[model samples]
Target: MSYNKGWRYIAFLSGFVGLLGVTLYPIAISPMIDASEYKKIQKEARKNIRQEDIQPGNMKVWSDPFGRKKPDSE
Candidate 1:
C-alpha cells in the first residue's frame, strides 16, 4: 500500500507538469506573415488557371437531360 501511494503521487505530479507545459506552449511561440508576398503568390496561382480546365455542364450518372456524354462501354 505504501509503494502504491508513492507511485500514485508521482503519476499525479507528472500529469500536472505535462498540463502546465501544454498551457504555456502557445505563449512561448510566435508566427510571422508577409501580406504583399502572400498576395503575389495568390495572384500567380489565379493566373495559372485556364478556361478549358473546367467542363461547363452538370451531368449525373443516374440520369442525363442534355445528352452531353455517351454511355460507358463496359
Candidate 2:
C-alpha cells in the first residue's frame, strides 16, 4: 500500500522525537551517590596488587637468520 505525504511526515517527526529522547536521556538524568560510597567504589576500582603474583608470559627470542650479510669468498 502506498503512503501519502502526511503519513510520511508523521513517521519522520516521530522518529526524530524518539532519537532526541534517546540521545538526551543520559545527559538529562544522572544518578547521585554518597561521597563515601563513591570513595569506596573508587578505592576498590583502584586496588593494587604486586606484579610478581602473576606468572610470566611467553618470552620470545627471534633471531634474524636472513638479516646478516654473508662473508665474502676469498
Cα RMSD to the true fold for all candidates: 13.0, 12.8
- Candidate 1 shows a clash count of 0
- Each prediction's TM-score against the native? 0.33, 0.35
- Assess each prediction's global lDDT (C-alpha) against the native: 0.67, 0.68
The best candidate by lDDT is 2
**Which parts of model 1 are misplaced by more than 4 Å?**
1-4, 29-74
Q: Compared with the true structure, what per-residue lDDT tens digits does model 1 show for residues 1-74?
A: 45547879899889999998888765553212335666788888889675455535643334566768877999
lDDT of 1 at 43: 89
Q: Count the backbone clashes (under 3 Å) in each candidate.
A: 0, 0
User: Cα lDDT for residue 49, model 1?
Assistant: 70
Q: After superposition, how far is residue 14 of candidate 1 from its true place, in Å?
A: 0.2
What lDDT is obtained when candidate 1 is compared to the true structure?
0.67
